[model samples]
Target: MDVQILFVDDALFMRRVIRTALNECGFENLLEAADGDEAIRIYRESRPGIVLLDITMPGKSGLDVLDEIMKIDPEAVVIMCSAIGQEKTIEQAVRKGASDYITKPFKSTNLAGIIKKYL
Candidate 1:
């Protein structure tokens, strides 16, 4: 399959917003997971090229999902996205092997556009 990006967020609105931004950037191979468990399942089945993960959620926060994803594939490209003032959580995510972190309210251009080059 072609390279793809998975947007993992508890908020459906945030997922749609992120998807729209990616689409505007000319990316069409996108996927979504409203919660961590579904994220893991999809990751296993599809093995998307990248993951845009939100930190806060109802259960199994993005951090936890990142850990699980890393366990499944150590080379997984996971970018943690969190609201401002959550430096500690972001730091922890980085320490756990997240490829990058972005603060919320970010433009799609802020999402490591060059990342597509690597994929």
Candidate 2:
């Protein structure tokens, strides 16, 4: 509901930062998950319209979650977020049904642009 978005990251700071960026871009319905397992649980329950996943998390990792999400819904809209140097992981996520991959340290404009494309 309300253009739902779920954001998964082990770091609370990163979650807040991305949530804030999305809010600045006029997005309001945001959910937060601290790890991949929790992200998967929430995804099944809430069925958010969009998901933003961080690749390097505590357990299961983003790619693992992406696979799980794809299993649940082949058409799931997922955007993988990777750090500056994780090209392989990003590529793998894309191959596994992620809608796109966004390199970390991104500007609000860039993130917003990606979301707009999905919208």
Task: Give lDDT per model, in order.
Answer: 0.88, 0.91
* Residue-wise C-alpha lDDT for candidate 2, range 28-85, written one tens digit per residue: 9999999989999999999999999999987698889999999999999999999999
Q: Which ten residues in a row have the lowest lDDT in candidate 1?
A: 110-119
RMSD of 2: 1.1
Candidate 2 — worst ten consecutive residues by lDDT sum? 1-10
lDDT of 2 at 69: 96
- Please give the lDDT score at residue 103 for candidate 1: 88
Task: Give one digit per residue, the lDDT tens place, for model 1 in 10-112.
Answer: 9988998898888877778998999999999999999999998999988899989999999999999998899999999999999998998878898888774
